[model samples]
Target: MPDNARRPGTDSTDRVDRTDRAALRADCASCFGLCCVALTLTRSADFAINKEAGKPCRNLQEDFRCGIHTDLRTQGFPGCTVYDCFGAGQKVSRETFDGQDWRQAPQTAQQMFQVFPVMRQLHELLWYLTEALSLDAAHPLHGEIRRGLDETDRLTRLPADAFTDLDVAAHRDDVAGLLLRTSELVRATVPRRKKRDHRGADLIGARLKGADLRGADLRGAYLIAADLTGADLRLADLIGADFRDAQLSGADLTGSLFLTQAQLNAARGDAATKLPSSLSRPTHWDR
Candidate 1:
């Protein structure tokens, strides 16, 4: 399972308010260790061992807590630390299943596992839609965003059997179109001369230290290990941009669109890294 750890909210200067995002965050204590058992863990730099789907990790305790929770990175499970189900675990574990754990009803284990990923995707859409609705620049599309949010939220509450045949990809496509429109509206606030488009660009290990990337379209960009130190990413559309091992020390990400904590967790940063008030400074950052 991804850590999805919570931090205190800072001053508000971003798109979405923290209070509105409380339910979007993962609450592992209220969950049934669904991520630990339902997801697969391939042996890699991110994982210490190979774990098949639906099998509890060896470190998972009887109480649904990770035995090595405090030292997952040192234990070669860094990948687990960067994952966030957007609060889908507890929704599926408690509300969907009515607090009946898989252990208590072994017959429902596989069904619950199947519904989890679907719910996670829905929750992720909710996260994005919520953020989109909060953007003043996207005000013209607020009605549409609200409809999308309500429909996505409704899909999340569907019965377990409904998920088996749900066409989630189609729904995601519909939501993605709306988000693209929202991105266009928000990024238009930046001057045309300052806008850059790097959508789906391969920027792995690129040296962008002190680069000016304001209002850039970086959606789905591969920024793995990129030297982005001191880069100005304000108002950049960072949805789906992979920040794995990216250096963000002294970088400014205030008002960046669709940036998530999981991406920040995978990157390296320092005290000088400026983030939106909605995000927390990763504890692993250099002090």
Candidate 2:
């Protein structure tokens, strides 16, 4: 199966990451290279080489860095740039064993490696929960998000020993429910106009290819079957816009604010469609 479920942090330098990345960096560098030693990878579309968990790659530098840092994409290792440790690697390295490189304490190496995935999963939860709080238009979800944030924070603060023993998957279910509700609340804010006020609205398939949807407020608009190929959707406020069965092939939604993945999944598009990074092209369009 394709690793379609990407852990958050695509735009690692995006606003959400920038806000707290300094703190993460501080905590991570003190790490004893846990991520380098603990994770495993298979040669796949994203990863160019395979690595065993706990065994550092040959290209790993003396400072526990990737030697191909600058030319990741050019050097056929784009996956490294795309992957975020979610702070787990650092936490394990520093807090788990007092920053002692597992190489020195060979007996603890196996246990540290075993706990790496668990901490990675918890850190991923923190990433999602943190992002959920930053959406300004998601006021309705503010309270629930705070709770999730608090819980995520608590888990992230666990010392290395407890972190290693964490049950990551079981904890995810609790947070997933809150995240789903948060998505609903955010999307619900998009208002449906009474009289199809789709002026400048970027319809996905209604013969609107190459149309202009600037300054349009398409709250809950049923855009299914609208042809929005090559449409200009920059600065469009598409709150709760329905994209079910919409033909958005070649459409540009990059600057369209408030567009959610759930909305995109409900819509129809093909391989010919150009989507925002936040959203994925529907699989039916895959060759």
Which candidate leads the pack in lDDT? 1
| lDDT value, candidate 2, whole model | 0.61
- Please give the TM-score that candidate 1 achieves against the real structure: 0.92
How well is each residue in 107-176 modelled by candidate 2, as lDDT tens digits? 8888878776777666666656665676666667877876766566566556656764577677788887
The top-ranked prediction according to TM-score is 1
Task: Please give, for residues 1-287, the per-residue lDDT of candidate 1 as tens digits.
Answer: 22222212422232233237777788899898999999999999999999999999999999999999878999999998899998899889877888899988899999999999999999899899989988999999999998888788778767889999999999999999999999999999987646488999999999999999988999999999999999999989999999999999999999999999899999999999999887788877753
Error of 1 at 257 (Å): 0.1
Off by over 4 Å in 2: 1-30, 193-287
Q: Candidate 1: count the clashes.
A: 0
lDDT of each: 0.88, 0.61
Model 1 CA lDDT for position 218: 98
RMSD score of candidate 2 (Å): 10.8
Please give the RMSD of candidate 1 to the true structure: 5.5
